[model samples]
Target: MLSEGWAKVYITVEGDSGDIERCCEKKDSHMEDLSLQYVNLEESENLERHRTEGFSSSKALVVRRGAPFRVSLQLEDRTFHPKTDFLRIKVMLGSLYVIIPVTSSKKVSSSSWNAYIDPEGLNLQSPSIFICSPASASVGCYRFQLCVFTQESQKAYAIGKFILLCNPWCREDAVYVPFEDQREEYVQNDSGLLFMGTPMNLVSRPWSFDQYEPGVLEACLNLLQVSPWHQKNTRLDYLNRNNPVYISRVVSAMINSEDDLGVLKGNWSDDFKQGVHPSMWTGSGDILKQWAQSGYSPVKYGQCWVFAAVMCTVMRVLGIPCRVVTNFNSAHDTNANLVIEEYYTETGQKLNVSKDSIWNFHVWVECYMTRRDLGPGMDGWQVLDPTPQERSGGEFCCGPAPVKAIKDRRIDLLYDIPFVYAEVNADVLSVIVSKGRVISYSKDTEKVGSLILTKAIGFPIHQSITGDYKHIKSPTSSLTSRRSTMSGDSTLSRAGSSNGVSVSLTLDRAQVAGEPVCFTVKVINRQNVAKKMKVHFNAQAKEYNHGPSDAFWETHGVIKLAPMEAKVVHQQILPAEYAHVLGDNLINLAVVVEDMDSQERVLASEEFNIASPHLTVQVADSIVPNKVQTASVSFTNPFSHPVSGVLTVAGAGLIQGKVNFRVLSLCPGGRMEQHITFVPSMVGTKMLQASLSLTNISSTIRGFKMVSVHGA
Candidate 1:
């Protein structure tokens, strides 16, 4: 550790080939002629020191490329008198060396290493060594040596060796912003965003973004394949740094399969899964570090929210201002046509095949930057989706879509603005088909992109910014207009003409696992005469990526309705009937009503998900930065057989690295307890997350706890 107010010495020596041997000597030698000896160099003050059993010098020095660094040195019996002795500094990498001459300093500070000396010989102190790395500096470790020479010996003494490493986020090469608050939030890792569950509203829910882990930046660089000596061909290589092209490449590569180094390999399944909860991912740094340590294999199984949250970490670590955004009732406009179509059989069974569908919600990232590549109007927040939903430039990635362009409905803009635009503004059309022919149908124009949101900075609540993306139109206005347009002769002829009958369906309450599902079906007759109708009800549990797999239950009944009158029929499905096939605890129910007298059919359907109980993790006390705290986790095994696996705990500043606990055997229905002790190294809102995995059962349960850490 460097002492306060003490100046360090750094000497630079330059000479011919014959002088190299003299400077390389380890011991000090006294010569009759003028000579330099006792030269020593210490590692930079910021590098972490690891002391060995018998060694005092640092094992290595890690320095970020382009970061301003200082080194301290000392010389025995040799005083660097400005007028008499000439000092030279040689920076050596491999066999190459750059000779730098020592000159008088203009100004010096405690943190600076620039050479500074007094006029009087006795007042003169050691030379202050300051080095500013350029952006072109190759990243790697190098050795530096200092030498001194006099006119008589014509040789320089090599007194010391210093190790220097170049890292990615160097101070001199990265963009410099003027606002302290913005800089701290974007570059300093003070806060970050994490998404949980599915999106429920247009406004983003509050998620803690912790970016200040010690290895986070290093891990991020690893993602980009950036090292001290080599730069690999990643998405980052496609564009210039600090420009929109680079930003677009980064956003696209984040979720796309173009780069295997991408963090998320998306998988949506109830069983044979990994990472059950997005909140269990406490910070980007730890996640990235894990990937690096695992030999750069992409982290297993991530959905939209996970991809977006991790993207926020990488962007912020690279000094790019970023945040996570959520779109509620987001449409997956698979066909590039702003319409999501659903098909049903005459008996009300929903067909499993469709090119377009809508997701409950979708999460993406937005980065702030000046769009020098796109010219004046594009400077600001650009939408970027790490989710590999759509392809751009033959790769699975989206955006850098200018928010301004999205708001203005500039579907022609670069990237995937049209895809993103339809995510919020797409029209949904439900059509009924009988005998392979289209019949009655309805269109809901306001269903998709119902809400767009991001968390408000410095707040624990969601901030709705829907107005910034699209104007929310009245549902009635769009519905009436769409009905009129679809009621044209062409549409009516395509929809088999039948005696006027309308069918609608509604659920009694939210569906839950191990519980009955009850719903109501209503049939209305518009004809003057009474009519008989056949009603069919079917429930199927299907995977999100594929068509309906198996029918869980089915029922059909007959009903008679009076002229211009409506009749309601109620049905209940027991849990045992569908529980076996309920793959992610989700079921799609469809109901169809047919007028027996006219052979006309109407269909209605609904999809619901059942959520499982989550594990619980709690902190024992209030947390202060740099202070240790205890966290306890409790998990109850719901299985009937014994389970055993690993429980892993991780957080950005809460722990240095991931902590793992082993479970030998947990009895059926038994509760497992784990206590973890860690020290919070940063002050802010932080998250501590843990996951319990049972290899025997092939199940994983996750939980998280958020705490505010105050400065010590």
Candidate 2:
């Protein structure tokens, strides 16, 4: 932080340890002004050694335990004589403190703290010291103290303070990641993509994890400190911080304020006036800063993706390899029967008769670590959901459940494997109920766990990890499997066709906002005589996990299908009708064909998202770190009337909290261009994300550009 040797940094956040006040209490010295105590914290050099660049912007010295980082000891107006004086470093976290003596010989321990004078600075006026912490040391804010022992006097002074995190770069650490590239991508990369939309069409939303951004890292550390585990038993929480499994579970529970005072409060309704809308968030910096600034009040309006993305930021900040995963057609089997029941009326109205629901897409986080608790082969990527969908172990948290365990159906394992298993492998029962009586029903096996997606390493594309969570050939019901192999549409997962009459619903695959929504329903009759059927059609906009909001379109009519013939009916709803009711949510479309003569009805439905208009961000293909670069963002209002709001640009390792640009107004179909300059601080591939929030419509439009920062 200093142009000379090093600079002392002080930092504090909400829920920070009490010892920090003591560490920074005072610089009182036993000796006179002739010899003042000074410990220069070499943040840049130590950050490289500790693999803690993610928090470089933080005022606290962020370092991972189990690694040796360098610090310079400077005593004013004093000539150091190694034989006459001895130097020691005292580290304290809350009620726990340890004093490690500085020795000439290097000492490394997996169970205790150690330190030594750097060999290169042995003869220098300001000697550099290398401090080492045990791999099992508790992770949190620590007060650094220096004790100088001389023949004439002994003095201890508060020197500096730091935050300790899990050491993924240390082999002796439980969270150690062996591969360099994997660590760089998972733990170091502060920007990522969160997958959304239906399984048929995936939307990659860029997210700035903002680990290195100012104050974000402090907020993350504060989250761990204020957790229920830490609050209930500080000693136990400190001892358990070494394991990624424990840290992940704690983070999962702390990301959402369900039963505790965590970071985000979950909200799925249309209203988000108390705080920022979940969809408006393009980065974690603002949300985290708000939480820390608001005295740790849970930030309003967060859904699954928001929770998962913030959790990923926290996990990565703690040096755990983490990524976001999205499961399409994700089922929430509340009864644990692994069956999701969806009821429909004979007239094609969806009835919320069952507590179970299938989210069109659900987001969660996956952390990578050695699973020593679950035994061998159970390591690798594990699912840890921050969304408070259900309670596990008396807390509204889920996982630390291994993806391996989920895929192998090892529900007997620890940490809510059954719940995660049901999320991806549940069966759906499409039941047509009439007057409280089941008329016809069919089971769908391929619907759930249709796809599991994560952002690919070093690429913007999505990587399919569905096989990592479920078998390739998941078992299906006999009736459904028979129709599945009948060679119709390979991409479509359909059921209930074997009931002699087949019904299928298809939507215009390339549906977009500001355009007419179109779909077709095809009904086939295999019976010999003419089939007279009452056709029922309906559509409603719905949150991915919640029930439908208001109906956008519906119709009832009579139709006739000739023997052994199929009829297709096309339907379209203008943009004016649905534009008022859509924003990152999906449309639930369903139809029921009732055989009036036979008094039988069949149901078919599909869920799809309307893609929002894209904003374009242009930046140079290659950028130099520490050098200013200009980027332009252009957006054209797609909707009618004038729109106005704030446009925010943010990127971890590139920009600070958020760069805001005000937009007075833009007429319909009018383009707006904004150019901004920023200096990229860190190297490697970093994402520059821009988001436009429209206050008039309460909508957010997002765009991102990946820049390769090659130079130091």
The number of the candidate with the highest lDDT is: 2
lDDT of residue 426 for candidate 1: 89
TM-score for each candidate, following the candidate numbering: 0.69, 0.88
Candidate 2: tens digits of C-alpha lDDT, residues 1-712 = 3456455432222245433333223333454322434567888888777777656767778888888888886666776767656777778787677778888878577788998988764744678888888887777888877766565555566666888888877888877888888888888887889999876556789988887777888888889888889999998887788677888888899999998879999998768888877888888878888999999999997999999999999889887889999998899998999999988777666776689999988999999888888899998888999999889989999989989999999988988999999999999888888889999887887789888889888888888887788777745432234233322444246534645577877775557877787877778897877889898888888878887755678888888888888898888878887777767778888888888887777788877888877789999876998888999999998886788889899887788557999998899899999999999888878899998888777467889999889975
RMSD (CA, angstroms), candidate 1? 8.5
Candidate 1, backbone clash total: 19
C-alpha lDDT (0 to 100) for residue 674 of candidate 2: 97
In candidate 2, stretches whose alpha carbon ends up further than 4 angstroms from where it belongs are 1-3, 6-37, 75-87, 124-126, 150-154, 474-488, 557-559, 625-628, 637-646, 653-670, 679-684, 695-698, 710-712
Off by over 4 Å in 1: 1-215, 226-239, 244-248, 254-287, 290-300, 459-463, 474-504, 507-531, 544-546, 563-574, 581-585, 625-628, 634-648, 656-676, 692-701
The 10-residue segment with the lowest total lDDT in model 1: 48-57
lDDT (C-alpha, whole model) for all candidates: 0.59, 0.80
TM-score of 1: 0.69
Collision count for each candidate, in order = 19, 0
lDDT of 1: 0.59
Per-residue error for 457 in candidate 2, Å, reads 1.1
